[model samples]
Target: MKEIMKDLKELMMKIDKFNSQQLNMLVEHIFDISNEDDILHLIH
Candidate 1:
């Protein structure tokens, strides 16, 4: 779990550094791959 958290933190920092184009693609990919729980968390 700590590893997951660490990786996710790294991912978020990387995401934060993305310019508009990369962030757009990332958002698109996230939507494409997200499961029900993931979608629920986002919306809620």
Candidate 2:
């Protein structure tokens, strides 16, 4: 759980570093399409 949180934090930092609105919107769309279980499986 902690590892997953850590990984997610790292991923968010990387994403934020992009500083691109298009990329952010794409990521947001992906999240909107994904269910929680899908995300959990991805992190694992």
Candidate 3:
């Protein structure tokens, strides 16, 4: 879980310049995907 948190932090840093709407969409997409491999691919 700690590693996931680190990846999430890295992802947030990468998306820091995204607009509010884009960020919301990304967050929704992340939650919509129930597959662990897909989420890991996304975060990395």
Best by TM-score: 3
Which lDDT tens digits does candidate 2 get at residues 1-44? 99999999999988877768767776687698658887666557
Cα deviation in Å at residue 19, candidate 2? 2.2
**Can you write out model 1's per-residue Cα lDDT over 1-44, one digit (the tens) per residue?**
99999999999887787767787886787789659788667657
Error of 1 at 36 (Å): 43
Candidate 1: worst-modelled 10 consecutive residues by lDDT = 34-43
Off by over 4 Å in 2: 20-44
Q: Quick one: ranking by lDDT, best first?
A: 3, 1, 2
What's the lDDT of the predicted structure labeled candidate 2?
A: 0.79
Model 3 whole-model lDDT (C-alpha atoms): 0.89
The per-residue C-alpha lDDT of model 3 at residue 11 equals 90
TM-score of each: 0.42, 0.42, 0.53
Q: Candidate 1 vs candidate 2: which has greater lDDT?
A: 1
Superior candidate under lDDT, 2 versus 3: 3
Candidate 1: residue 27 lDDT (0-100):
78
- Candidate 3: Cα lDDT at 32: 99
